[model samples]
Target: MKTANNRLDIAIKKLYTAFHDDCLHPECCKQCAVGNILDHSDAWKHFSDDHGSTKLNYIGHVNETFGKRFNGYTPSELLLIEVTFLKACGYQLPLHFKNNKPENPTNKDNLFKGLQAVIELLCELDKSPNVMDYTKLFDNLRISKKSLVLK
Candidate 1:
């Protein structure tokens, strides 16, 4: 059994690879956020009918009822993560053609935003610090302490 931390690490790494390879896509189940977390499996698509929808379907409810977890995330949690990714990527929920979407879905900036949001959620789910967060590296307190030591 994989620990939550281990699952989160695997998810982050997979997402990083997807983003780097420009394989992340809102329309492709195997390239979506949850899909990447599940090792590029499109099985997660059965969780919801719509691409970005959070409302679970029959399969999702059954899985959730059985306490099934895919890659350490429950069915509902997977939907939340996917919604977060799509939203951050500038897609309106449910992924309709009429809904708003990024002018260029594959743009690095858009994908980076999506990845960041997904990573944050993954960290939150595991109660771990977000590895993608580098802001702490520039903390003034740490910098001041370093300067004092240097002095």
Candidate 2:
């Protein structure tokens, strides 16, 4: 079996490699949200500009557009909001899965290069996916009143 460290290394390496083409090239990036943020900030800014769209409008629009296709409020829509806003602010998040509907704190591991990344992820959470999946990260993670409130 692989050690935790080995698994982490492979995961990170995979993250970088999976996005290599989209990271450097646009045509391959296609409608990729994080790629757009990384390689095409200006265009992403158009979507996320001006403190950008709020969770209400942004999510509602997605619900109408892609949500209709997926059945409703999926990771795709949430990821779009997450990636677009983060990119507008200049942090390219990982687009790991094709249909990933990111809940909150989806990948705290994505430490982004630094503080800016953290803040962007925080802000995006305020605007999208209302669940805090990283409750598992806290040393105090447990089923309590707070956890229930958060849930």
Candidate 3:
């Protein structure tokens, strides 16, 4: 069971990845060189209110200073890659969400579910003051990488 502190730590790490890893210009080693993770979402205010910096909802490092950029991957390709990466990382993902749900949900349901779970958890944490302890909520939910089956 993850204590509130541990869950907070986990959330911070995920938020860091989501915020810092995306480079519209995949070749933008300059931004990577900066190695800074900035908050790109409104969740930071909520986190500050709770006196916890781990309640991350939507985080990303978007730099408008750079002009047009080229990332070798198309939008669809980026989504696929993100889905695969998250799955390989052991996060549950959702497959259904009304109009935007995937047709082949089973193919990467876990990945979607995992991503959704993270966002949802962050949202819940943002909204609820007592949601600091997420042990019961995330214990059985998050999978260990060791349990992943390489197929």
Candidate 4:
């Protein structure tokens, strides 16, 4: 069984590859955030009829009931993660073309924003700090007292 951290690492790598390759998309199951995390598997689509819907379908509920985790994320968590990604990418929920979507879905900036949100969610799921967060590097507490005392 893979630990949450292991899953997070794998997810980050996959997302990085997808983003760099311009393969990430809000509409494509194999290219969406959850899809990439699941290694380009469309199996996650069975969790919900709508792409960005948080409400799971029968299969999702069944899997949730069985405590089945795909790459260390529950079915509901997967839906939430996808929804978060879609929202961050400026997409309207459920991902219908009629709904609002980024002007350029494949734009690197939009995909990066989506990936950032997804990574943060993944970190939350793993109960770990967001590896992408660099603000902590500027924390005053981490500075040495000696460094504060100028010669």
C-alpha RMSD by candidate, in order: 2.9, 13.7, 17.5, 3.0
Writing each residue's lDDT as its tens digit, candidate 2 over 1-151 gives 1223432233224334434532322113322333333333333323332322333346445555654422122434434544443443334344233433334322333323222332334335345321233545575655565778986
Task: Enumerate residue pairs that collide in model 2.
Answer: 75-101
Give Cα-based local distance difference scores for all models: 0.87, 0.36, 0.32, 0.87
TM-score of each: 0.89, 0.24, 0.20, 0.88
Model 2 accuracy (lDDT, Cα): 0.36
Tell me the tens digit of each residue's lDDT in model 4 across 1-151: 1334777888888888889888899778888999998888999889988888999999999999999999888999999989999999999887886887778888888888999999888888889888888887677555765577754
Give the lDDT ranking, best first: 1, 4, 2, 3
Ranking by TM-score: 1, 4, 2, 3
Q: Against the true structure, whose lDDT is highest?
A: 1
Error of 3 at 36 (Å): 11
lDDT of 3 by residue, 20-131 (tens): 4443111121211011112232222221122111222222112112221123222222233333334433434422233243234233343334444444444343353333
Among residues 3 or more apart in sequence or in different chains, the pairs in candidate 4 whose N, CA or C atoms overlap within 3 Å are: none
The Cα error of candidate 3 at residue 83, in Å, is 0.3
lDDT of 3 at 99: 24
Which regions in candidate 1 have their CA more than 4 angstroms from the true location?
Answer: 1-4, 140-142, 145-150
